[model samples]
Target: MKNDITTRRDIEQLVNTFYDKVQRDAIIGPIFIHVAKVNWDHHLPIMYSFWAGILLEERTYVGNPMMIHEALNKKSPLLQYHFDSWVRLFYETVDELFAGRNAEYAKEQGSQIAQLMHHKMRESEQ
Candidate 1:
């Protein structure tokens, strides 16, 4: 079992694998490619920093995540679905790569973030 503080390398691998799947997923692939235009080559490191901050209590992320997601919501209009898929992929990635307390923490934090994002997206609609 590996530590699950979601290190830079861990985050990188997770995002890479998840996006690889996302690129092929029918429901979510087009949304990400068309709306976010996520250049995996460029975006992965930023995401790594963001996740590192979340799991490690570091300050690697300094930008406004909500604002970014809000923009994405406006484009996708399936924010909840995206959020759910994101969590699902994240859990699967962590489970595949690590275990023990770190993995548990990742699950807990990922679930909470997903729920929070779902709520925020719903709120934005109202």
Candidate 2:
């Protein structure tokens, strides 16, 4: 049985594996790689901090992801399917790596975050 995500190492593994899938995914890969021009070397650590804070209460992440996404949205025009793909990849990654309360919490939080982001994306259009 897979262990629950219970440490910083677990979060790193989760984030890394998830982004690996994201980088390869045709649906969302271009949005991140081409449109956003994400620098993985720098971005990965920020994601680690972001997820670590959400899952482990590490209090490490400090940035405005919404603003970042808002700017990215202007570049490529984020749509519902983009957010959908993101949430799907995240849930798949979590289920593949871990199983337990924390893992479940991670999925819930991820789905909510995606939903909220999508909502904001729509709001910006109006």
The best candidate by TM-score is 2
Pick out the ten consecutive residues of candidate 1 with the lowest summed lDDT: 1-10
**Candidate 1 has what TM-score?**
0.84
Q: How good is model 2 by TM-score?
A: 0.98
Q: Write the per-residue lDDT of candidate 1 for residues 22-98, one digit (tens) a residue.
A: 78877788887887888877777787777777766768777887778778888768666676787777788778877
Candidate 2 stretches with Cα past 4 Å from truth are none
Give each model a TM-score.
Answer: 0.84, 0.98
Off by over 4 Å in 1: 1-7
All models: lDDT? 0.75, 0.94
Candidate 2 on 1-126: residue-level lDDT in tens?
999999999999999999999999999999889988899999999999999999999998999999999999898888888888999999999999999999999999999988898899888789
